[model samples]
Target: MNVPADDITGAPAELSVAEVRTAFQAWLHAKASELGEFRNLSTDVDEIFKSLSRLQRLLYSEGWIRLGWPEEVGGLGGPLVLRAVISEELAAAGYPPPFSFGTQEVLGPAVARFATPELAAEVLPRLLRGDETWCQGFSEPGAGSDLAALRLRAVDDGDTWRLSGEKIWTSWAQYADRCVILARTGSLESAHKGITAMLLDMDTPGIEVRPLRSMNGDDEFCSLYFEDVVVPKSRTLGEAGEGWAVAMFVLSCERGAAAWQRQAWMRWRLGSLAADASDLPPHTAGEALELIHILRLMSRRTVRSLSAGEQVGAVSSFDKLMMSTAEKFLFDTVLSAIPETLLLTDNESARDWRSDYFYSRASSIYGGAAEIQRNIIAERVLGMPKD
Candidate 1:
């Protein structure tokens, strides 16, 4: 229902989450015609990025995007829950998420907390307004799940740091304006302790980005090579030997807020799945709904914790686990109910289904693999034995 309130001016400083949602919903309703063309999904990545950037700029100008961020970083100052609502409401309205959502959720908060004031003030606003995009550079050739084993090295160079290493599985690096990188500054023996996180501009010399294609056949991820890349000391997110903490924080958001957004998109996809798959069995649909509902509930709690400024920590593993299983289950249902359309048809919709199906298979692998999440749950959350 609409709030019956005046147009939202993006300065609802004291509004509660429900109030914010009401006003935002009303605004969306009022601006329906203006945002109509943005309602559809784009097949091209460049198109998607460009369209999302435009959307971000619109939201920023309308003040809607600034509701939950600090004024120092181009926001109007409100609870972070307001930010989460913006994502949920957009997805509920059939808009694919802004490409900035993942990076903003995963990396923005870390920089806000850890970067120097000057850096945060300069970079966060660009990120929020979609003026720039950022990527997380955590995993290396040998480090994915076990991030402590990462070997990307950063050497101190007085005013700057000289970085030399490779980072793989970096999402959207080709389009990123900057990267939140974790590199080792001490001996390998120090492992996680010797690492530090840096906020580096993507255009820096000696940095190469090579996009890689997965089974979905999209180059959504890339390999980043750093050859003596010079990074200002001011770009450091946290002190030396503190990247593990920074990494943990980013992962928390990845599994928490990103999962929250994923569930929203998945809910929309579930509805679309039902509409497309008339032959989909009732039990299968019921099962899928229930799984998605569980993810929504788990993610909601994590979001609340985050909005309240609580560190969600390892509890995010539960959400990640649920998210992966639920994704695979949903797409598996698509494949089963529409095998010919999903596998043999040549239309755009068919190709989309095929791509989604393959991408869903990797859901358990990214954001901490299924096996590793189980270990975290068993030993960390459940307090069970390590083995």
Candidate 2:
């Protein structure tokens, strides 16, 4: 956790963004050498979670994961872009970022913004230190695209609220210690205005988490059922009926800053494939490089705007759209240019490629569908009239 004296002196005194980036890159390179070789142990979802948790704990102990967070959350105060630099450096050094990085970027912002100060202080550090895992309980079987139509109900009972409904596509719920859940608190006629957000313990009574096996042969996503699950009123994020705003904030972070991390990984994967392939097609490398470039540029702008405290709003849909396009395009290029590596090779590297290729299909569907993003862009960004 000892930052170089030179870095401390330069920072905030005479340092520029470029200087910070350079120092951080050097620090990451040194850490990478110390961390040594990484092995892909198992493709099993549980094993992957365990491995990622261990990796997160290591990074947390090293202070890399706490760079951009507030000091109140056990972080060393720095621009949010410092965290992005960490992820980029890790990927550039051929290491997968710890899974908690995604949760921190996606959900941590919501908790910091909406949760009580005491709650943020108590729980944020646990998250930063890898003491717990969290999941988003926003999507339902019937409410993936139109989240306002979600039917999960939460009724206030003086001091607590009883929740009843199921959440589909809840990622890593089986391994999560906490969940940021959105439930209906008003009449159905209220739509988005009826919803409320809460942070719930996964171990609470009347809750069931059932893992769903994906095409990649992993159970990363799950179905969560609640039978009158009770949550304390103190767990509410923002005011009642304002869950839509909280949800929008989380989704903006997901599509904006999180997309930067995804683009970094895509760049690393492209480089790995280029190094491993012997007979790639004439245009395959060009196509893959172009896709990564486009994604990186789009994601960078989105990240910068978010870091500047601007209300990125629906403009982030562009980032989400580019991410889906780049991801699917890159993976498709890989599958076509190196079909043997994806389908026939038996080595661990090839297995990893195949698994990644399979998961890339969901890239367009998970956060929001590609079509949904385009629609948002057309209506909101382009000012197109709705049909």
Candidate 3:
């Protein structure tokens, strides 16, 4: 699709980060007339998610979302850093990313890296174009952080695998069109070594999704049940016993690549916080900005490593820890600095602040817990003896 004449002057695949940002800002300004209805998306999760999906289609049509992906997967093909810039610019321009942005960063790269070429070619574009949504099924009722302990059994039936088990805390699974699921293929003694990963169509029989409403009153997470959900061998992400490696890869992206987007959005949120509570003491916003900058530095390194073809590995745990810290600190300041607005006001702005502040409490628990990250750092990064 052709970019609006006023916003693009060159091929998307060749544009530098700075060039893309400048051009994209112009496009956003020009498209303001079209995007007016999508503003203030965060106030309502359902409306925001729907609007963001439409926003994804808008970005894909302009070729902005295609820059960092491979041409074979229906992308323009450029440095991974380009993808970071696109998300940053969107958040900077006052648009919350489509939910797909988070899933795309967390799962898209892993699929591109491990899925068969035909499978990647067929599904990746659907995700990119916002024609469908997907969820990760790594966490089970019994397995939250200890992903290897998951018991979602995927028994091999010669030509196809039958998945039977439950997954919990899968965000937005109820609306997903597909899922990236991890299941056991070997005996319990094998742990992670005996597991396998597959890309399963969510519409398959015996698959069910029931969204879990969080304290924020939004059904943003779900519990997924699979009862002999049949998946073809061609849908396997990698070799049957190599799911541990795939899980590792997906986790790294979730913490690192996604953090870049998170930081950019956090920076915007800080700006909003500052503006809304300008009457507060200087130290409040000062500390908040400082913490966010530290996170930006950590996440920037992760992004650069990813662009340079380097695996972030355990380092992303550190990023996640810092990310949660920044998020919690930022919102804590919001509640403290503007108590009346957050606790007393009745407008949409106040409602948004209240909701976000509550959600920030989970920053430490989601995307692997802060406690887990500490363990990883102490053992894996610091080479300390595990207790």
Candidate 4:
């Protein structure tokens, strides 16, 4: 796990997605032996994260992971789709993405867009290099999917804000180096209008992280407590009382670009499921393929639109809804096909299947519940009435 520090000097300033993909494939082939250690990572979540960080370091050293970001933030300067291409290629090669991949797509863009230039330049490189990890601080007690209902309060304190509240269902908060949190800056009645987004170092005083173990037997989620945590005004993501825009933008990336990454990983998992199940039913496999392909198309459109600086708006709700549907169906089909692997066996592959099966049950809940997505599509996208 000893990765040498690398100066980002030789990376290309520009490259098409196709060019990036081709070169990346070639690199993977040439580095197959060196990358073999990542093929079978340890079951311990901490170990898995450590090994994945090494893989990320390798990719960053070679400039694959940094390809579409701004050079000012440690990138090679290409269309954002270039990074997507690299991620998909990694999955195709049976490699797991760096743990920071999701955060990079979800919170990284918001930081780059809404944060001050100095902040973006200072923090984004650490994210790109996997030198740091971040977690989103959106969901809270009684505000899981209804983000506007969150009650985390940010009180004015002259040059800083004092934060006090609890945030639930924060993914990997215990290991995070930073967090993008939303707090109420106005009256409770103001709801979304009074919200404001801010960036905070996870190690700040008066902050506590309590890990929550999921059914998958992993401490993947956490509950964060901020008791009079002081944050500088310079850390505000956007203007005070304008955090709704930041929240919306972050959620858009979560549902849009993050969906793209998830679908890629799911597609790879589908292939793994097929190879492991010797007697896998043809119809089930076909059905799974169709579901994954549909998600692929939807996610691809969203990724392209986002790369082009286009606002996908409520339509991304379809991608979010379909992603969960496809994921649940895919994993459910896995459990149904190989009940023994998931429920009876104790080997590594079996453990993987077992973990994924249990985790899939939550697909309908995280990143905005499936019901929330449906409601968004119905009321916002289709002009349906909420009665």
Candidate 5:
């Protein structure tokens, strides 16, 4: 609870994921008296986000969030899996991660790997501390599955690059401070090779964010418009034409490592259902439990692969596919077994179930669509010939 301040000049000791988890759990128990009670507060999405942000900042300030990051980036330095373990423990304990946690997993790695050391040192700490939020700018109206077809254009200027295009289904863009944007920097004929990645400030002139409502009754996704937005050369990620690699790296993290966190949350939801659903049909509970078990097994392998710095590559498609199947299956079970609670109850517990069930539909859509993951698994992982 009383983490020492960052040692600017001194080398910090590295801690393994297990050690960090044990320390964090011990700290959580020690601070249990001061920590706020976990509430289901599911109705107000903004309020829930605010509360989660505050929680992340608290953990960040105490140095827990910095454990797995590099000392140069304000972390104590350890295997990145340490952070993953922390997230799993938190979610298993019934604490929803701070809304920005996904950003750390999805975007943080790419930046840390490709960004200038100065940039990584300057920006990543802020992200860890919840002082800033970042969003991916990959999917476009026509580029959802065919990302190589994205039309966003970024032309190099002497001092800054000019960007113009639209990105759709960008989550939390309205609340994000920075975005890892992909744009066409070469000819349309170049396909993925011509694309480039850039880190742009959300407040840049000529940029707009329009929130889109989901079936869950929340504005969690947004459509972003970039009209000749100027981005500094320093904002570029990797080489001018290496955006595709950066994008692939980000997607791999999303599909592979991020799935671990989701599995942990799913397992927690399964336990909650078992505890609360008194009238649940036996078969329904059994099916949900089976799905959770499958997801946990698949995600555990993916997490270990990622933690070991393995390429994972097309193999991650299997993990993504299983995760989507498991998520939808578990939530469908919830809806069927607890229809009254999901549809009619107005309490926070019921609202959480309803909202989660609605959001579960997107599980197959985000990261990559279920169809796309299957296609990858068939063509790449299994080496099956494309039809």
Candidate 6:
């Protein structure tokens, strides 16, 4: 797709974060009536996805979402922090982010950094425009938190490689058009050193997606089964046997940039909880707000560091750990403040509350468990001895 015309919104190619935020907030206000519909969305995951996809398209057309992306890859060309402002301002305005927001931050960076320029130019725009959704196929049945132990195998076949493995807890794989998957191409004893990251089309033969129902009653997570699936050698990310670096980069984004998005959403939820819970104690609400603020500060630092091409390394573990802590605290406090609404009410708002509460229970477990985060900090950050 061609870059958005200058006359569309007349935004400069390079904009400061404040300018981007002011312009975006102005657009949101001017289009409030048009954007109001997204303030309240369906509880059904598929319906929510469909609705947000439209929102993403609208943002793309307006050029807000294109800011901070390179012109070579369908972006308007600015610092990445400009893109972060879009999601923050959207949530602050009571709008849900596009369905692919998390994937865009988590996987998009890795692909941009490691994929061939031709591949990045071809696919990144589709992802940014919400024309396609992607999933991360890192966590296997044997390697949820211990990602280095993944047993997925990818055997070389000259022009292509054959992948056979099972990936569990893959979020929204059922709706993905493509997936970035990690497979072992070396000896089992090689651990992380043997891994290779490859991008694959989800429609490829020998792939099966089974949606697993979460406690929220939404099939948000899925099991991806690949039986000798063929992937071109060209799709390999970085050099073979060097996937560990790619994986680390992806994890850093997942734990950092994605956390930025999550904290924004959490702050929105905190505001709603404060409004709904008439009897909520001031102290309880204050504490939750404090945790959320701490998360925002930490996540912002990480996002900016990433925008400047700095490696955050093990420091991102703190962001992941605090994110889960703040999320669980906010939802737990919400449960305490309005037990009846979350437990017995059948309305849309109540269902959202119930769903959020249930999903929050997994906050400590998903995306590298809290315990694992602590271990990383102890060993890598604090320089403490491992067990």
Best by lDDT: 6
Model 4 clashes, total count:
0
Relative to the unseen true structure, what is the C-alpha lDDT of residue 376 in candidate 5, on a scale of 0 to 100? 95
Worst 10 residues of 1 by lDDT: 1-10
Taking every candidate in turn, the Cα RMSD to the unseen true structure, in Å, is 1.5, 2.4, 2.3, 3.3, 2.8, 2.7
Error of 3 at 50 (Å): 2.7
1-387, model 5: which lDDT tens digit per residue? 333233311332444445566666777776765665543444666777777778888888777777678889878776777778888888877788777898898899899988989998989999998888888899999999889999999988977899998999998898899999999999988999999998989999999899999898889889998898999999889999889999998998888778888888998998899888887788877877787787777767777776677876887788788888989988998887788999999988888899899999999999889999989988987789998
Tens digit of per-residue lDDT, candidate 3, span 1-387: 334434442466666677777777778888897997776665666777788889999889888888888889988887889889889888887788788889999999999999999999999999999989999989987688787899999998999999999999998888889999999999878998999999999899998889998987778889998899999999999999899999989988988989888888889988888788768678878888888898888888998998888978888998999999999998888888899999999898898888888899989988799999999999998999998
Clash pairs (backbone) in predicted model 4: none
* 336 Cα displacement, candidate 3 (Å): 0.6
Q: What's the true lDDT of residue 94 in model 4?
A: 89
Candidate 1 lDDT, 94-149, residue by residue in tens: 77778887789889999999999999999999999999999989989889988899
Residue 370 lDDT in candidate 4: 91
Compute the lDDT for candidate 4: 0.88
Tens digits of per-residue lDDT, candidate 2, 1-387, equal 344624443333234456656766676666665556343556666776777778778777666677777878777767777778778877877777777779999999899999988888888998888789999999988899888999999999989999999999998898899999999999988999999999999999999999999898778889999999989999999998899999999999999889999999999888887777777765878877887788888878877887777888887898898888888888898898788879999988888889899999999998889899999999988999999
**Candidate scoring better on lDDT of 4 and 5:** 4
On the 0 to 100 scale, the lDDT of residue 260 in model 6 is 95
Error of 6 at 49 (Å): 1.7
Instruction: Give residue 338's error in model 2 in angstroms.
Output: 1.3
- Estimate the overall C-alpha local distance difference test score of candidate 2: 0.84
Q: Tens-digit lDDT track for model 6 on 1-387?
A: 232234334554545566667767777888999988799888777788899999999899877788878878888887889878989999999998787988999999899999999999999999999999999899988798899999999999999999998998888999999999999999989999999998999999999999999889988799988899999999999999989899999999989998998999999999998889989999999999999999999999999999999989898999999999999999999999999999999999999899889988998998889999999999998899988
State, as a TM-score between 0 and 1, how close model 4 is to the true structure. 0.96
Model 5: residue 305 alpha-carbon error in angstroms = 2.8
The collision pairs in model 5 are none
Cα lDDT computed for each candidate against the true fold: 0.89, 0.84, 0.87, 0.88, 0.83, 0.89
